[model samples]
Target: MNKDIRITFRVTPEDYERIKTKADQAHMSVSAYVRAAALRHKVVVVEGLKEQTHEFKGIGRSLNQLTILAHEGRVSVVDLDSVFSALEKNYIGLCELAEQERR
Candidate 1:
């Protein structure tokens, strides 16, 4: 089981309005909405970043590797589109997981 802690912070007027608007659009109270957003972002960041850390540090490096490999006749092409699709799927799944974790 996971232990939990509470946090508090102050937001500027513009950010407060933005969060409130987003909450309203989702038909949730401001607190629920903020919690949801925070959970979603945190899960995606944690799950997605693990893989990225070993990918030579960033997308530019990954692209460079792909290009270098292709130029050297080491591989036929880049599979970046598929990689991106998988990453998107991971993000969505993590977001769902976050909501579940919050509940």
Candidate 2:
């Protein structure tokens, strides 16, 4: 989409500061943040999601290593039902959190 159009509005100093702070928190530019807000877009900022993502990456690495070991016959691969269940639970939790924030 070509966003060549521009829109301008004035706000009180306190409102400007609040909007700037929210934009910073959302890691978006002021224009983008304002545009999203004006468009009634849900801007969810879930805390610790980054850390959770990092942990998921680490789990993926460990799973990859386990797969490699199993392929080499160096280790026996057992059922991963529990692991998958936990991952799914966490995923659902995150989704619910985002939904709650949207509300």
Candidate 3:
């Protein structure tokens, strides 16, 4: 096994406050949060993202309904345009969020 090494650094007061705030929100120690951030790890807290969660669940329900209709052989008879439109909008929103995360 390898021994862990220490990395010490300094930041401006404002930067420190920003890091501390993010660490507090992530429920991680300052060191761990900084380390993960430096490593580019995706550490998202879904509890603070209820709107995205709700949108995702709504899209999931729409997809489930479509699945049920297909399984019951009723897809051709039902008007599915609105359901598909909602799913597309939610999917685009999610894609935009993902793009923002990459930056």
Candidate 4:
């Protein structure tokens, strides 16, 4: 979008601070955050999600390494019931968090 137009509004200092805090949590600029809010967009702030994503990547790397080792006959494949359970739990937690934000 061109975004050639400008809109201005005034808020109390306290309101401004609250909006800024929310924007920071959402990792968006004030203008973008306000625009999304004005447009009724769903702006979700999922705390700790970035750390969880990094953990997931690490798990993926470990699984890939394990697969390679098994293929090379260097290590025997082990049960993955616990691993799957943990992943499922994390996924469900995230989903619940999102649902809470929507409400």
Which candidate tops lDDT?
4
Q: List, residue by residue over 1-103, the lDDT tens digit for candidate 1.
A: 5537767899999999999999999999998898788788744334544554444246557677888989999999555886687567666766775676566
Error of 4 at 76 (Å): 2.8
What digit string (tens of lDDT, one per residue) describes model 4 on residues 1-103? Answer: 7899999999999999999999999999999999889889655678877766776787788789889999999999688887797788778877877787678
Per-candidate TM-score against the hidden true structure: 0.36, 0.48, 0.41, 0.51
Instruction: Show where candidate 2 strays beyond 4 Å.
Output: 1-44
- Model 3: lDDT equals 0.80
Q: Which parts of model 3 are misplaced by more than 4 Å?
A: 1-42, 45-49, 62-76
Q: Give the local distance difference test score of model 1.
A: 0.73
- Steric clash pairs (candidate 3): none
lDDT by residue for model 2 over 11-58, one digit each (tens)?
999999999999999999999898889889655678867866876787
The lDDT values for all models are 0.73, 0.84, 0.80, 0.85
TM-score of 2: 0.48
Model 2 root-mean-square deviation: 12.9
Root-mean-square deviation of every model: 10.1, 12.9, 13.9, 12.8
Give the residue spans of candidate 4 off by over 4 A: 1-43
Error of 1 at 58 (Å): 20
Candidate order, TM-score descending: 4, 2, 3, 1
Arrange candidates, best lDDT first: 4, 2, 3, 1
